[model samples]
Target: MSVKPEPVSALFAGSFALATLSAPDGPQFPALVTPDARVTDLRVALADEALTVRGLLEDWAATLPRLRALAAEDGPRRPLAEFRVHAPVEPRQVFQSGANYRQHVIDLHVAHRAPDDDRPEEERRAEAAEIMDRRAAEDLPYVFIGLPSAITGPYDDVVLPAWAEKPDWELELAAVVGRPAYRVSVEEALEYVAGYTIANDLTDRATVFRRDMPQIGTDWLRSKNAPGFTPLGPWIVPAESIADPGDLRVTLKLNGETMQDESTKDMIFNVARMVSYASRTARLLPGDLVLTGSPAGNGMHWGRLLRDGDVMEGSVTGLGTQRTRCVAEDAS
Candidate 1:
């Protein structure tokens, strides 16, 4: 049977669900959207082996409108609840910003100061503010690469490795690249964005710092790239749909208690700067994910790290909610 065609309204719509439908044939389609209002089933709006979803993202300006229009058409529909939601797109490159949130970095500086320094809280705040101002004025964004294998579905279960002692959650707003960006200016950065999504950048706090190699500092690979460490998606809201990425709120809850609640307005570099900074050194292709960093209120700040059977609910204003459960890795 042929997939149903999407409606024209879907093309102009600001939000759409690009999902993988579970079929006996296996996971099918990378760009399927719900054409009807009920979202019972998804229709194949765009499918190409070579370009994939990443290529479609390169021309998102044209592709999104087409997809939105397709979504308006009445074609084949599937039961939305029966299929599992994958990371909206399979990114060829993933760039995550580090210490890019104003309040978050400041909080770390204050909390991790030398015990003997004995600086007052006000002084620490002032110092941190000065440092941030200098970085913003002279320095570029700090970005690191992430393994795509670490990605999991929005509602997937996160397996806490037996070796990880302090699992933590970082709710962030992730931008989906729609066009090629290389050495682009900050003023033109947002033009490369296709849409936005939510990601929970789970971390193993205990492994963040290498005690043996203090000079080397952070060990992001070991601390942040475990399987199912990045829980992403639910939906990708078109960039046009988001009036202001900088103003959105990022909230996370541990189990049933609210843990992290902050706004993107606290970002030290903002999305445009982060994207432009990343493109300066690396060629950003369509479908590449650029995480804008998490705000303050991470588990490290609360001293309440994640444990087995813990649940994490992360949400961004326009993006969507992601619910993940933490389970202990099975010891063989």
Candidate 2:
């Protein structure tokens, strides 16, 4: 039996407006606009309406014009009352990359390893010097995982869980898995990406690292995967829209002050390397989320932590920005 082609719709006025494209076969088509622009889940409308699409990222762009027209002419924008952003698909697990940025590695070395736990002060300094000498050649991507419970919506208020002592923010660019991957090479990694979104990989730095034993840096999962820890999205922009993921600007603001300001160019290990390395260890399935790691200037290293009423805003150029108000555990 032949499958029937599906019509795509944009949701508005508690109903969906059907969409149409100009050049349906072309790549990167424009979205139709009839009234306003607000999108919740690009996947649901495509599926129920029999839209001819593979994933959220691919389908959205392919039917862009039709969707845009619906947004512009159909009706006024309604408030997203109960909508929340989930991983574009249900991810098997969330993976994290560490020290992928050069500045991040350097900062970690100085803040986490320079004090030398096993040797005298003078000897430690000398060893640190040697470690610096090897930095250029020894650089490699580090990977970890974040718990599913840590995830939250883009604009949702983040409550400082009572168990956390030193909650910190790590602004990162995240890639959504599009297809099942196993033993993929760096060159073929991008093909698996559905789209990209912003991620704040919140950390509890005080309990994460041990100063006395520098070798034991921290527990990767525990530090980053605490409850209400990961805040993701404003929206997922298709990879086609991003000109260069490596060149995008990343910034973080805490209570309205800029903390981290840098470019993805500073990353020592890029996204492809992270995905390739991770897939080698285990199978990476559709919807698995990967965080590209954060830059320097997290709250922990500066002896600060998230306090009640602290607002955090983070963004990547071309992607979108997100703001979350911090509240006490009981108050939320």
Candidate 3:
């Protein structure tokens, strides 16, 4: 497929605005927002219509004019459809990184630590450095092929697959590639970004295989690919709005309870560095997505696993949120 790249300036312009979702508190004033207000997933919006801008980032920036037009219309607006959402641009290959955050590293060590033994500060620091260096040498982006079957629209129900008993939630900020990026320097990496969105990098923790094996033999697939594993949307906010991709606020709630609350500042490998490293081998095509790692408070660490009656909620600062119910495999 010959993918057309989105304009860099349009996608990475540093401007962001919070989407107003709730109705006005005062009863007298007509709702500034309407009940039919619907958020569209980038892939879905593009497939249902020929976007004036071909690339995801450019299309997102291009939609501003259309949104203004829609707001001007006197009548009700239309809601987004399920058929329109693509499997978040299934790239030929995908990569991810492990222990890419200070918190993540500390959390890993803490989990492995014996309860009674508190390592001295200096000892902890030395151990952390060793762990980080080992992870860096692997140089393998902890990426997984986001299989098509595992993708769904923003509001769609995430049906747990038959074999999946350990569904886990990971709230993350996802980036869309607006241009062909290869071997780009960290300084020039952000230039290749198009926009950003909210994504829950859901995983089947039990399915994770041994990482010591060669890349193709044991990683990626087992860690990321599962039916309805990646649920994204609300909308791809133009990158220009976000002053810093690494500093956005992110959160994930389950069944109306707040689970993860943190800022992207905690990431050990910032966006530019992450992008620069991954593009060294494969060119990041337009529409390609990069999901920054999740925070420490995931359900997997705790004994609690996702059940059928649960509802999943994930969101980013400026980008809207994704709300989906988790239905058991047999129910569907």
Candidate 4:
């Protein structure tokens, strides 16, 4: 007989958010987080003890009703603070969209202009703006594959590689897929999204380009694939909970100062387009994330870069927050 799978969550409003959490030095399990910071262990509440966050996502449509019923009627639960929170879901693949924000790219063009190009600042800025307009009208998104091993918890420490001269943060809104999405259209893209979460797409700016082979272009592998480079979720806020992922505010604070504060409305390609564009090539499975690019005001834009002891706080509209401290690895 086919095994019945259950999800690790339930809700407060219409649905509850899912989380992967555990006690100190204990085995991780899926649980439903409440609005009051209490959580119900899905293992005890559901029929299958082996039910997991991923399994829940894999069968989202079937388990959704049960989730609602469970949410309305509470049972045994615990405080959220008593457990160590983890990345809400473990995905086999992660797709990242780059240079998708309108204003962010324009600022980068001005900031990283050629030394000899001494055109007036306004004239240069005007040129970049026109280029972005054209791209939005007719161009494919610049999407790249990110190593899932780079995933870490919301409160985890991000170890900055000693070799990295300029470490940067790109706080973005990540869409968590529920149904298997392959070659889905933009109109149907949101239908497959189960939830949304926060992601900081950290990059080693110094390693972005391969000096040895300029013609080969950007090197995302070396620039982004470090352990704990991508600090994901405190929890997965169900897509239904977020009325519009394309209109949320993506903000990041470095230490106590606000660094990146922009709206998803500023994106050249919205969440639906990004997810649809990515699925054109790859089969996005349950738990896989389609990371919508970050908004403006990156470290480079402010003439600042990540250093050891730097604490970053990032949050997306309804998806919750992630706080990761930068730790410089000792080369010697």
Alpha-carbon local distance difference test for all models: 0.78, 0.64, 0.61, 0.87
State, as a TM-score between 0 and 1, how close model 3 is to the true structure: 0.71
Give TM-scores for every candidate, taking all chains together and pairing residue i with residue i: 0.88, 0.72, 0.71, 0.93
Off by over 4 Å in 3: 1-49, 52-95, 114-141, 210-219
Candidate 4 at 284: error in angstroms?
0.7
Report the poorest 10 consecutive residues by lDDT, candidate 1.
1-10
Which consecutive 10 residues in model 2 have the weakest lDDT in total? 1-10
User: Highest TM-score, which number?
Assistant: 4
Where in model 4 is the C-alpha error above 4 Å?
A: 1-15
Clash pairs (backbone) in predicted model 4: 10-16, 11-16
Winner by lDDT: 4
Model 2 TM-score, 2 decimals: 0.72
Better of 2 and 3 by TM-score: 2
Residue 201 Cα positional deviation in candidate 4, in Å, after optimal superposition? 0.6
In model 3, the worst 10-residue window by lDDT is: 26-35
lDDT, residue 195, model 2: 65
Q: Write the per-residue lDDT of candidate 2 for residues 72-102, one digit (tens) a residue.
A: 4534433232223332233458898776666
Residue 108 in model 4: lDDT: 88
